[model samples]
Target: MTIRYPNGQKFTPVPLRDKREQPRDHVTFSNRGMTLEEDINATNAYYLNCGMAVIHKKPVPVQIVRVDYPARSAAVIKEAYFRQASTTDYNGVYKGKYIDFEAKETKIASSFPLKNFHDHQINHMKQVESHGGIAFVIIRFSQTDELYFLPFQALYTFWCRMMNGGRKSITKDELTACSIFLPLGLSPRIPYLDAVESMYF
Candidate 1:
């Protein structure tokens, strides 16, 4: 299958690794090689099951262009294009407050590159905040196995600095100073709501 962006750029999906290739450790609370999105999905599921919150990943809008009838009962989509660029990863309501956030992970140890974010995403977050909603970003430093919940205001500050021809990245120390550190857990995986409660509530 071939999927293209709204700008006609080919979209290459990341290949999933086999679980058998990963080393099994005794520490269950650790991330255990799960991607940030996977961990968040698991945490959202837990929240939903426990009647804590209502959140879900936003689906990308795609327009199917070509399909092949491989068999009488099977139809294979061959080509598709995104209908539009997505704003953020997830959004919903929590504790009667609107929640919107994007999740990103990097393998860098010293800093997280600002190039990972897009202008539209930042603008969307700003709009969300302007309307009295909570907007934030969840960043994962894969090399250090660290996670941080950075509010949109903090992110906007760094983004504005970059736009003004300053540094092109956010240092780990800067994130530590301005963002809330999220500890890994077993049931929720990434315990971000705890940080949200501490910072916002």
Candidate 2:
């Protein structure tokens, strides 16, 4: 099967992991090993435990068509399909303010590809912004081990330019000028809310 963007641009689903290989031990603690989803999940748990906020990853509902019961063991999923396009990776309340955002990671050292985002995601952010909620993206540059908090307004500006035949990636300088770098830590490894407080609040 093939997937295409709304603009008819061919979209190739990047290889996430080779099914025939097992991840090696002693792998560095980087975005290559841990995805944004995993980091946010752990952070959300920390937030809840510390009474900081209530946030959750929205599960993508799916229909399971086939399952293989191999020997008397666990069942393996054979076929499944997403029910619909996901709105956002996460949403919650922080300091009595509603928050909605998406998280993305890039291996590129210089820029984040615009292709990493979709039109639906822009629309979702617009909706959040319209509701007077905080909307933004947490972008991680794996090569540099740097994470930045980019507000939705900045993202929307870049997105608009992309639609007008601008560069497909946001340059490092642009990110530096428009985003707030989040400090790494032990608990809530990516302390983005700190940046939020300093910049937005």
Candidate 3:
């Protein structure tokens, strides 16, 4: 069967990537080789299972353009596009306090590049803060497998400095001084709430 575009043109699939070219697992948090996002999702599941916290990843809004109805199955989506730019990655209620945060992974060990973040994300964080919600960023140094929770206040400071033509990134030293180090755990994988409880809650 040939897949055609909306305009009757053939839809050529992108070439498959080589297995060796795939992202290599760096951290042994679970000893099972999971990406940072997967680990965080597992952690959130663990939290929800035990009635600890209620954090969740925000869904990306996709506008579906076309769908194909199969013979005996549900319709399959053929085309879709994002409705708008994503704000934060995750948000929920933890102990009655509104929790909103973005998770990022970078390979740089000395400093985390601010280029990974967008202006809209910073603006959303500011909005969350103004509304008395807990806003922060969870950063993982993929090469070192080190994770840190940097609050919005600290992130804002670094962002402003970058805008002022200062350093374009936050150094590891600065993160160590201002951020909360999330210890790796066996069950949840990324036990970030421990640091949150210690610092904020």
TM-score of each model, in listed order: 0.78, 0.76, 0.80
Which parts of model 2 have CA positions greater than 4 angstroms off?
1-33, 66-78
List the candidates ranked by lDDT, beginning with the highest. Answer: 1, 3, 2
Tens-place lDDT per residue, model 2, 36-127, is 66877888899989999898888766889999999989999999996654577789999999989888887678888777776988898998
Give every collision pair in model 1: none
Ten contiguous residues minimizing lDDT sum, candidate 2: 22-31
State which candidate, 1 or 2, has the greater TM-score: 1
The residue-by-residue lDDT of candidate 1 on 105-189, one tens digit each, is 7767888888778799999999999999999999888878899999999999999999999998999999999999898998999
Error of 3 at 60 (Å): 3.4
Quality of model 1 by C-alpha lDDT: 0.85
Which candidate number has the best TM-score? 3
Which regions of candidate 3 fall more than 4 Å away from where they truly are?
1-34, 82-84
Q: Backbone clashes per model, in order?
A: 0, 0, 0
Off by over 4 Å in 1: 1-34, 68-75, 82-84
The better-scoring model by lDDT among 1 and 2 is: 1
What lDDT tens digits, residue by residue, belong to model 3 across residues 1-201?
468888989976776654456446432222123487788889999999999989998777789999999999999999999775458878898999988988887766788888777899899999999999999888888888889999999999999999999998899999889998888888888888887788786
